[model samples]
Target: KTTNMPERPFDSENARKKQHAEQSNNELDENSPTNNNEQSGDEEDDDENQIKGNEEEDYQEDDDEETPDFTDDEYGSEFTDDYLCPELMAERPQEHESLNNVIIVDNLPKVDPAKLEKLKEVISKVYNKFGVCRNVYYPLDKDGKTKGYGFFEFQNEQMALEAVKQTDGYRLDKNHTFSVTLMSEFERLTQVPSEATDIGNLLSWLTEPDAVDQFAVQSDDPKKTMIYSNALSQPILLEERSKWTETDFVWSPKGTYLASFHEKGIALWGGKEFRQVQRFAHTGGVQHIDFSPCERYLVTTSARPGNSEAFIIWDVITGQKKRSFPVEQGSPYFK
Candidate 1:
């Protein structure tokens, strides 16, 4: 009856335990005169015999203690307590680990010793038609039979999806149907619950969609102007970069450019590189600056004790000064 159920990683360990129990009972029955065969002397069978012995030892139950019950109160809710493993209704996944680019294939027809070897050889070539396979795994029971399932890890996610889409319904043989899904699909607890962000998951935070836009926090104590993402999506550091004497940082009206003031001039910057885009040279930095509402004009002004004060307007994109007005140093008429 269990043969009809597809083999899934979620229920694998439980199925093994149930099968081993049944096998053990069969072994006890065989101990009667009907199973008095001599131990094999063939060296090739040694590994298989050893594996079987190990499995028997692992399943042996101690007479004194009771096995624990599967319940949400004890284990936490993740997989469905019902249909996830149809045949093994009470079974549960041992762990939930996502093998990102890997996929599981199952429901191959059971074959004899000779046919099983042929199936393993052909199945690999069949999967490889879609993409490069990084690794393959097929475990055999003690009897050396193909357990009707295999796992193929591809070089990338695209290859895995191609394999699944291309072969999902095709039959491996007349007796069984093929089943395929990402290894993540079997994981009952794919997400790790966390109370706060820490080193373990910090790298993932940097890749969030909001991490690209930037802002700045300027201060003299740090000696450096700190440029950071306006979204606070990543760590921003100003460090020791105190070079600008200008009191304010001006962003162009459209925000396509950020202007920094220094004793020499006003410099415009933009892009992912955050490099200086253009410089408007001034002997003494501007006292105030503003971008026209349409962002086509950049206006700069200077206030000084000398007889000459200056107000200039320039083309914002070309950095070409279009006009300049000289004002008397103490011009109360301008205020």
Candidate 2:
């Protein structure tokens, strides 16, 4: 107190040392057992935030990869709007509804089911002679017996008729004979006749529409009188002129011309004349004669016992001899 001492200025080194010591003390406090719980809590909060961010990223990826459902009716409704319509779905049928162009043979002799395949082969060969490939339907009954009939569908009506005329009553395998006729669609028609009940409506319904219109029984006697309805005023009369066993006869394509043949030569008649147009000579008895489709030629066949078997082709307009083909010895006699 007696001596005057100089006043000590603030020492910066001491202040720095005090600050460093306080920071070290704070760090030690955080590492202490009591503060460990608070430190772990902060670390857990950080981890939770990181996990939440990862979960959000996963959810976005899934949304991008997902596919839309297409099987639902709403999807179909939208898809069809631009591409499909009712008209496109529905298709129109063809004008010609006939199943085939050829003839169908419905009558065949009943045979053993075991021999069905052989029977079909024989029938096919007979059809081929008329220049046609046929489709045959042979169905069997429960007892494995042939129902005594089959169906043959051909490619052309002319060919079919030719086959029917040729092979009808034809003998196959020495024992079996067949009766053939045109197949009828009466079974498929809704309307039926009363007499059709006898033959199960198949035959009655199947009467040819054009045939019914053209031909009618004017008299009850089928063999004696038939009044044919023609487009002209004068109806034709099919009279049995001669008793020489006349089986079939047809008028020429033109109503002006008529032809009837017998064991004698071809007898040509006309609308104007009861006399013959031309008495053409054939080798044997004439079996069949047909006018060519173009009306230019006439085809005539003759069946004799041994030597006079021949088919003659003639010029229709001039009645001149065109050519002749010799038939084989055992060839069938067909008209």
Candidate 3:
């Protein structure tokens, strides 16, 4: 029981060989070219796939960037229908000739060449307050003098309109007043009206076939005023109008005009159709009217409240008021 079996001798040489062999096999496995080649091939394949995937993603991004996005915010909803398809678009309309940006200033003071620049400076100073003046053109006479009128071009139509409205009838001096108008209106005003061609001679009524004297009558009904030829057998109606006269009517001394009284003033009617030939504007009501013996002048009397000038003398043919007289404390209303 006490005798120990001889301990197995440690096999140092055999153990060392086995361990060395195992370490060599392991190193060989790690350093083998075939195994390394397979591992590297797998890595290469993965890299190629990764690169291809990146290239495909870049191509997709390029395609997205190249495609046009026709959105409402960028091109508008009607761009395709109105601009792209030319046949679907309507033809552009022609623009009318307008002088909307040009103004005509008349009644300016005429100046010689020496003072022309000074006058222009003065005019520009006045209009520059309203808007920027693009150009100022004053026509020159043969003697190199500035005309009394000029053309002003403004930056826009609104400036021209404001200039015309504010400066029309503007008094620059005691003797000079501005007659401002749009160039467009100047063109229209220069052309005569179409009705001017249709106007017949004023003395056509004097040539009646029977030499019958024509007389106008105001009926009891306010609307029924009539003119008649004083025929020998019967009164022949010539023309009639409703509410022609307000209070009274008169005939010119030579029967050249049939005058009708109106609250504003008097209306002179003549010719074959008894058309209105002229009108006089008296602010207050006209109570009495008298024509000169020769029918060359008309005198109108009005009793205007708080107004001293109640008498107006008008040139009949020209329809221009020649003079006005103020009422005195004890003087008669009319002379």
Give the top-scoring candidate (lDDT). 3
Candidate 2 lDDT, 126-236, residue by residue in tens? 777777564677778887777876777666667667777887777765656776666544354435434411212212312434433233232323433243544355656
Candidate 3 local Cα displacement, residue 112, angstroms: 13
Q: Score each candidate by Cα lDDT.
A: 0.69, 0.62, 0.83
Candidate 2 vs 3: which has more TM-score: 3
Task: Judge candidate 1 at residue 275 and give its lDDT.
Answer: 58
Superpose all Cα atoms of candidate 2 onto the true structure and report the RMSD in Å to 1 decimal.
19.8
- Model 1: residue 186 alpha-carbon error in angstroms: 77
RMSD of each: 34.2, 19.8, 13.5
Model 1: lDDT to the true structure: 0.69
Give a tens-digit lDDT track for model 1, residues 174-211.
Answer: 77778888887765535554443222321232454865
lDDT of 3 by residue, 1-335 (tens): 59877755677778889999999999998789988998999999999999999999999999888556666476566556556767645654222223788889999999999999899889888899889888889999999988799999888889989999999999999989999998877766797654542447777866778888888888876567999889999999988888888888989888888888887899998878888888899877788788899999998888666556588899987788899886665433544
Q: Which portions of model 2 show Cα errors greater than 4 Å?
A: 1-227, 230-245, 273-275, 329-335
* Candidate 1 runs further than 4 Å off: 1-208, 211-213, 232-246, 307-309, 329-335
Q: What TM-score does candidate 3 get on C-alpha atoms?
A: 0.45
Better of 2 and 3 by lDDT: 3
Query: TM-scores of the models, in the given order?
Result: 0.33, 0.29, 0.45
